[model samples]
Target: MSKQFDLSVMDGMDRREVREYVSSLLWQLRLCDGFWFLNVEKRHGRAEAEAVNGLVWDKMGDLAARDVLERFGPFADTPCGFWKAYEYLPWIPTVECAVEHDAPDAEGVIRGITVTVRRCPAQAGREKHGLEPYECREMHETEFRRFAARVSPSVQVECVQAPPDPTPPEYDCRWRFVLPVGAGGDR
Candidate 1:
């Protein structure tokens, strides 16, 4: 039996066209998320909006991870695997993060990696509109944890810095992913 592939609107498009379409879609996704939070904040309040936003992101993280695994996965349960899978995250392009993989130790064991958001579109948008920064520390912490757990339950996520905590001028947020000693990762 043969399977059917639904190219849908993407059918018959050239590689350049597909890239353009995907770029627009990424922008739209980011815009929609920002607008959703703003609408919720306007209707309820910052606290309520933030709470709902956190809930949504928590689920999104897990869902995104699951989707990545399903599409391109079987990534090893190690720091390297986590980083590889993380590169495919939906928000990677939209969020524009700078990920730095750490050097291996003397024993040649991969320690982990650090992700820094130097220019967060969400924060920049809020600032551009003269709004207060969203206290996203907790939300991102949960999001990262949920995402990492899906990749490997033994993977540990640590929030080095995020909103609500004073961030350095160079970056809006930074997260550290720690691989267990025996997690089996290379340089």
Candidate 2:
């Protein structure tokens, strides 16, 4: 995977590092997702694709959290922790790079943040493939909240917006992260 991604390609170039990284990440995601589909379909069956997607989603969240912890040190379950964790998402570079405009515009509060993906690459890719958006709404309900729960059980994930549903021209998906209604955290 590293071999195909050339850091030198971005060396003092036209300020396109983010673009390069997005391309690299997109290539990687396609490769990994393809491999997962191929093997899982052969070994298990086509019926398990959603399950496999969810499994990979969960593991990726954990791994991303680990990376953030290693780089930024531990964080308490606060709105700040949520922001820090968001930086480690594998999808970040891709989305940030691909969007025509500012992608994840974050509205921050003491105990929560609402992130809106103005343009979703996953949505575009699926459209390009003549496939409908994957069941992200269902996946995020449990898997996304579980991702945040890795930081703290109180952390909540609500799909303010997601795919397989109509979205207006302004945005593709929006996620609200906050402590449960009664959690001690502020905001």
TM-scores for candidates 1 onward, in order: 0.91, 0.65
Worst 10 residues of 1 by lDDT: 1-10
Question: What TM-score number comes out for model 1?
Answer: 0.91
Question: On residues 132-184, what C-alpha lDDT tens digit does candidate 2 reach at each position?
Answer: 65556666566566656666556777677676677776877777776644565
Best by lDDT: 1
Residue 29 shift from truth in candidate 2, angstroms:
3.8
Q: Residues 77-160, candidate 1, lDDT per residue (tens digit)? A: 666777788788757887767878888787876678888999899899998999989999999888878888898666788888
Cα-based lDDT at residue 110, candidate 2: 61
List of clashing residue pairs for candidate 2: none
The RMSD (Cα, Å) of candidate 1 is: 2.6
